[model samples]
Target: MEQREGYKRELYKHWNKGLDAGDGCDTRREVIISEAIKAPVVTAGCKLTGGSWLSPYDGVTVSDAGKLDVDHMVPLAEVHDSGGYAWDAGRREAYANDQGSPSTLIAVTAKSNRSKSDKDPAQWLPPAADYRCTYAAEWTGTKLRWELAADEAERQALLALAGECPTTTVVYGTAP
Candidate 1:
């Protein structure tokens, strides 16, 4: 894996009008709608007003769409460090706006998502301890699916977390 020294968030363009751009919704709104526990009311132009989201990271149930953020499971900076720096603009944009797979993006509380921003398992984990297993599995699956490489510390942390999650499993296809 490449060193994380000079990573720039701007390198990866995010929140593009996604695969369903024709619907006039961006990636964030699309994730919010998809992950909503209660279907959100979408006004014209895909403005979401009401929705309930179960944040898998902190295990919090959020009622307002404004309180949630669509998190990139493998953050853009981390992806760039792993292997995305070599990709062209089109691929990077696709990854940033990916909605083809459920694991690529998730709806979680804004607080939790910010807390986890761009940090790998070695640097951070969900505040909710019980969720670590699921978190680790998802992280691993995302990396494997995207062919991202983990550094030594990250690999160690993931291995340790996997030890605690004997029954947790992930199945992912090729990257978008």
Candidate 2:
């Protein structure tokens, strides 16, 4: 496959330029708020101080929102390599800030998010064994949502994972 020339993280304007919801919080904060198992207090500057969250990627419960990372299910670089290179700047930005789908942006432990990095199902699976099926399904669904294509290795990995978890289903909607 021919790799695209440009895939700098800057191409996709992540978290947006300013406050996205008129509140002080940005996209990342919004995701944190939505995913928190226990609602955290929003302070004067939209600082999230306390929250209990379950990082599905590692099955770790986190008490500090600061310890959580809002991860793109299909990490940005993987999205670029998976055909997002063809997307226009606006679409790229939208993809980066997408919150319409719960599966697209997940809140997980910082460690888990960093470890997974920009890897696809072919390269990485969640450390939590129970999340493997869901992760694969969400990864496939996110690719489909953005009209992105998966390479052969990723396809095979997802297929093999599907074979292992026959009951897991992928449900997705086209991104606007």
Candidate 3:
């Protein structure tokens, strides 16, 4: 696949409160709520307080919502660099806030999520060694679901990681 040029995170709009109309929660909060180990106490306006979350990336358990981040499995800039630069604004928005599949967006510790910002498997992996297999599968599944292109190095890294996770399976449908 030909790589796109001039990729920018601004190309995709994210964290829209209205993405899921009438849900009252923005994309970030929704992810946190769904992934919470114990459901948080939500206010009438969808403000979340006091929740416990398990960060799959680092194997850390966090009870503070402030420490969690909603990570796009395929980061926005990576998506734009892959094929999203050509997508219409609505499609970009959908990709940014995609919650159709549990793998699309995830809740991780803010530290791990930032460390992974826009980097593919070729450049970054979870700090927790045991999570590598699941991470690779999720990464591949996200790329496949979004029809995103992976560079040769990224593909090879994913394949190698898959070898370590012989039983891990990826099941996904097309992106919106």
Question: Which digits, one per residue and each the tens of the lDDT, describe model 3 over residues 17-79?
Answer: 845668798888888998999889999878889879999999999999988999998888888
Q: 105-150, model 2: which lDDT tens digit per residue? A: 8999999999999888889999999999999999989989988888
Which residue pairs collide, candidate 1? none
For candidate 1, which ten residues in a row score worst on lDDT?
1-10
lDDT of 2: 0.89
Candidate 3 residue spans exceeding 4 A from truth = 2-4, 18-20
TM-score of each: 0.94, 0.95, 0.94
TM-score winner: 2
For candidate 1, write residues 21-64 as lDDT tens digits: 68988888988998988999998889888778899899999998
Q: What residue pairs clash in candidate 3, if any at all?
A: none
Residue 31's C-alpha lDDT in candidate 3?
85
Estimate the overall C-alpha local distance difference test score of candidate 3. Answer: 0.87
Tell me which residue pairs clash in candidate 2. none
